[model samples]
Target: MLTRFVHSGPVRLWTQHLGHPTDPTILLVMGTATQGIGWPDELMRTLADNGRHVIRFDHRDTGRSDTVDFTTHPYTLADMAADTTAVLDGHAIPAAHIAGISLGATIGQWLAVHHAARVHTLTTIAASPMGNNPGPAWTRALTGQPAAPDELPPPTARFLNHLTASAQTPRTTHQQRIDADVQTWRVLNGDTLPFDEPAARQFVEHSYTRATDLTAATNHDRAGRHWDDNRRAPLSAITAPTLVLHGSADPLFPQHTAKPWQHRSRQPD
Candidate 1:
């Protein structure tokens, strides 16, 4: 694996590449507040072994990437989408198969609709059709506005409660922050799957130690409030072949959230 920093205009994004440059490229975009390493090494190797070049990058304010002050340099998802293209440009890749999860998935959708030529195929996991607009509750929290009548369902009460509790709790010490991350993943992993606490804790520890400013990751949530893209087109505008994947146990986005994407992409549910 090769890791380096790539420039996205004034921002610098930390990126990693696996597999030969000659192979078909696959760009992996992770969720909100997640760094590039959030894509497990095993998964990257599996894709590389399958005859594909894989790339992953840290979004601004996460991992080793530059952190912007929202007060002075607030940016929208469109800017994030541009950052994605900058990764491609830096690698001298004209296009690649795009795969994203959660907020990353929403960025993939935006790329497919706006930067269609840069996307060969699109795969979205645990995401809503639109950006992080996770229904009425989130809408109220972010924008102080009620959601449209047809918006997707809100996240589960359990998940919301966990978020609230986490926010209220202090994590001033390194160990406390590590513990918080482990618990956060436990909630996200849900009850259906085996909760690998040791592995989760190890990963969180590594991430926390490697981060330039761990708390700066919260800028992503703040960025959501400043989202001002009025030119966002519908999903039907996407011409790339699409696959939508959603877990039934996803606490943030319910299974029903995938229906609109499936219908729009003309993919079987």
Candidate 2:
């Protein structure tokens, strides 16, 4: 793997590349408050071995990327989309296939809509449509509005309760913070899958140790509240071929949330 820093205007993002640059590029965008390393090394290797150039990056306020005070330098998802373009630009790549999870998936939709030419293809996992009403219960808490009748169902109560309890519990020590991350994954992993506590713990520890300022990652939540673009284009604006994936046991975005995306694009063969 090759690591480098890419500049997005004033912000700097830490990016890593695997596989040969000559191959088709796949840009992996991770979830909110999560870094590039959240895309496991094993998965990266598999994609690389398949003759694809894979790129992953730390979002502006996560991992080794530059952290900004959201109060002074607030940014929207549109801005985050621009950051992805910067990563491509830094590598002299004109376009790439985008695979994003959770909040990353939302940003992928934004790129597909506004910067259509830059997106070769889009893969959205565990995400609701971009311009649609919010799908997560936490988003309702953030916006102080209820989901419309046509919108996807909110997250499960069990998951919301876990988030609440986790937020309220203070983690003053490094080990406490690491444990908190492990527990968060346990809840997110759901009941069907065996929770790999050892692997989760190792990833969490690595992320925690590499972070520039873990607390600063909360800036993403703050940024979400202050999205500057009010007139968002509909998901229909996406011209790229799309793939949508959602786990049946996803606690945050229920399986039904994937329906709209499937209906919007032709099914992948």
Candidate 3:
């Protein structure tokens, strides 16, 4: 595994499970606060077995990537999109098929919209258009929602719920996923970071939407946000073929979101 600095040094893409660089590359961008290691092993291996040159990377401020306070430098989603492009440029990959989920999907949308040249095809999993959906309400904990501090649920409960609610897939012993999430979180956040309360509040504080956030925000939810954001440059603007996959049982983003993508994209969302 390698951690690469891109777009100067503030943002890093933690890379993993590398293959021959010459093959057709499928760049996987994970959701918020998740490292490259979070991608399911079975699914990742399946992509490799399918003869794909699979690549996964961590976004800035997440995982081992630099968490230095870029908050002062006007960090926007466009900056994150730039980071993805920089990673591709840094690795010398001319083009790639991009895939993402949730926050990753949000970034993928920005990549497709703002850095069209670097992406060959697009695959978005478990993501919506933008603001006001259940995503916003449910994520009030993460994004500093309800505007009232008293309404906030327990931080542990919020974190646990965030993991479960964000996932379209379900586990047999669901509690195991929660336990594993907490364990991994402990390792990632480190014992020195806030364990009980501070960490959760810290995460929640950074959740607000800034004016410079690149994606469109027309709809009440994430799906509409993406769709409306892309209004000036619809999915048809995407030169590459696209394949959008959605899980039917996902609690956070319903399967219906996939339908709009299918309907709107030049190929599919």
Candidate 4:
């Protein structure tokens, strides 16, 4: 179900509405460069069907949420975390079962660690624990580029392909479903249809600029600079019940990289 969300910013937030009203809340967080619609609806449905109230919303710079000028300040992950807190507070949700993927997953990681009071159980898929992975050499190289408005399309396509491929692969727990989803999203994202290249580019530029400097290097540098120059605080502070999920074939975040997180996760009790 698609619901109308007009609060929070200049542009109305577009979110997915599903499941029964009485179900417990499970807020789904989308990854970087992706809208909540990119999240698999079945997953939310299943959670709702299992007596959980599932919800997903677009981040400020993604989907139909309000867009801002990223050229002014260096948007840090911490700032993104604050936006999430505001969203939750506005919805009157003190805390809920939280789940996220990739950058969304990273946000969840930060939420559970720094803002534990705001989240209940936590689930992170295809994510890393910042600085733990250090990422790859090429990953570092990519982040070093200039973050201009024009640098949106190709990387956007490549990143989407990666997420689509990761969720649809050999021996995946949910491949057929993911394949259909990829097709559906492709249709929704097509230029001739509803959301075209311009929309896609806008979403990409928004995310890139929001969490990084206007003149910030591409995401590669955003992460690489942090990995090499920054010292990430430990996740040992996270007390929330946690679950970590990753695909063995994921090129961006391989299965082995999940080990660092496994050590810190409190059992979901």
Task: Report the number of the highest-lDDT candidate.
Answer: 2
Query: Residue by residue across 123-178, what tens digits does model 1's lDDT show?
Result: 99988775434435565644445544455556666777788899987888878878
lDDT of 2 by residue, 151-195 (tens): 566777778778789988779887888888899999999888899
Candidate 1: segments with Cα more than 4 A from true spot: 139-149, 229-232, 257-269
- What lDDT would each prediction earn against the true structure? 0.83, 0.84, 0.55, 0.59
Ranking by lDDT: 2, 1, 4, 3
lDDT of 3: 0.55
TM-score for each of the candidates: 0.89, 0.89, 0.58, 0.61
Runs in model 4 lying further than 4 Å from the true structure = 2-12, 20-22, 133-136, 139-231, 257-269
| Superior candidate under TM-score, 1 versus 3 | 1
- What are the RMSD figures for all models against the true structure? 3.9, 4.1, 11.9, 11.7
Misplaced by over 4 Å in model 2 are 133-148, 227-231, 257-269
Q: Count the backbone clashes (under 3 Å) in each candidate.
A: 0, 0, 12, 3
Cα distance off (Å), candidate 4, residue 231: 7.6
Tens-place lDDT digits, model 4, residues 1-269:
74746454343455566676556678888876566765666777788778877778876666556555555544566656666666665556788788888777778878887789988989998776643543343343355543332111122334445556655655433444344434434543444334454544444444443332322223323432343222255666679999989755454543332346444332121
| Total colliding residue pairs, candidate 4 | 3
Which 10-residue window of candidate 1 scores lowest in summed lDDT? 260-269
Q: Given candidate 4, what's the lDDT at residue 249?
A: 47
Q: Which ten residues in a row have the lowest lDDT in candidate 3?
A: 211-220
